[model samples]
Target: MTATTTTAPTAASDSGLTYVDPRAPRFGQAITATVLTAGVVLAEPLFIYAIAAILGMALLSGWRLDLYGFSWRTVMIPLVGPPERREPAAPHRFAKLMGAGFTVLASALLLAGVPLAAYLLAGMVAVLAGVAATTGLCIGCRMYQQVSFFRRLGVV
Candidate 1:
């Protein structure tokens, strides 16, 4: 005999999408900005590699195991209450991918004996992440949306 399973449909389940607290990404960005800034200032490749690993974990497992997101949910939510709005998780994931790419490149440059270029690249990421944290203008997320738009239009 064969058996089939049926599941009830809810908003998220039916849409096949998960929502995230909008503040979570900002929180993560703040940490990223600070870490990258310190790494550049101290000329420490170790710090850069640390952030790269965090970003890698975020990409590999998403919010389920993402340290920053877990911290924001468990710690920040208690102090700040729940977020005013929720956002789809896909864009934020894409943003993290961008961050990971940059950090990995920065690490490579540093390891290749190009300290000046490495620090400058890491500094640029810090500035962008800082802007996103403070201003809610996520360049990486915006880029993700543009790419999604192009994909939908069959232009990608």
Candidate 2:
């Protein structure tokens, strides 16, 4: 078994697409954090913004902007320079699904007038994404790893 977590992407899906700058997803997570935090702090229409942000994330996760020739993450995020490492897109896609789940739940709560639950869920996403963005520790990626481990062990 390989001890290293980061590996170059292969054709894991049917799309024949692979390889992504590890930082792109982190940068995306950072944006996810910001939008979600705004929704929690501002409330009302801003929560709609949070929903839109989540939808955008889902779109990008499906399309994988980095799989294309250009990554806004590379161009926008300073100090990142060129791509230094590539990782399989599968985990990131899974992470985005996790993010979408959280944000969707949060949005439903907010729409239902359950502000507390909404904020809590959104806050959780914000914290997770913040940790990934700042420390390069992706909570969703960790979750994926754990799930894979359990699957390998035949426990799940």
Candidate 3:
């Protein structure tokens, strides 16, 4: 008789765990980003505390914890995992890019003591992000596509 060997598969080796649909709304990421932005705007330290609290809870629980596909393992446990994979949501990409730009510009203005410009830009970004979060319609995405189209036709 030939010797036989059996192996058991664990969640660690599961393929299903590695797949995430890109078209799916990243509700957790959106929510977390929104909250963080709001906190930054308000100059609140509680936001950081909240993140720490959530992470602490996850660590104590030993259960899988994810925020917008970002795992607690990545955030705290120092465990390496597959990179986050999600469908490319054009609107989100546009909003994120523009929002980041606006944030940087606003910060520069603030550092330069240009209160009006800084506040105005920050307000605009907050409003746009808020509207996109609430309505699922991203003005930045439309603006980016419009610019892209115009540029392609040499319309500036």
Per-candidate local distance difference test: 0.79, 0.65, 0.47
For model 1, residues 49-156, the per-residue Cα lDDT tens digits are: 999888887777644467787677567767887656567767877888899889988999888999898898889889999999999999999999999999999999
Q: TM-score for every candidate vs. truth?
A: 0.87, 0.72, 0.48
Worst 10 residues of 3 by lDDT: 1-10
**Candidate that beats the other on TM-score, 1 or 2, i.e. the better one:** 1
Compute the lDDT of residue 5 as modeled in candidate 1.
Answer: 18
Native-to-model Cα distance after best TM-score fit, residue 155 in candidate 2, in Å: 2.4
What clash count goes with each model? 0, 0, 1
Off by over 4 Å in 2: 1-17, 48-61, 64-81
**Residues forming the 10-long window of minimal summed lDDT in candidate 1:** 1-10
Question: Positional deviation of 68 in candidate 1, in angstroms?
Answer: 0.5
Q: Model 3, stretches more than 4 Å misplaced?
A: 1-88, 151-156
**In model 2, which residue pairs have backbone atoms overlapping below 3 Å?**
none
How far is 147's C-alpha from truth in model 2 (Å)? 0.6
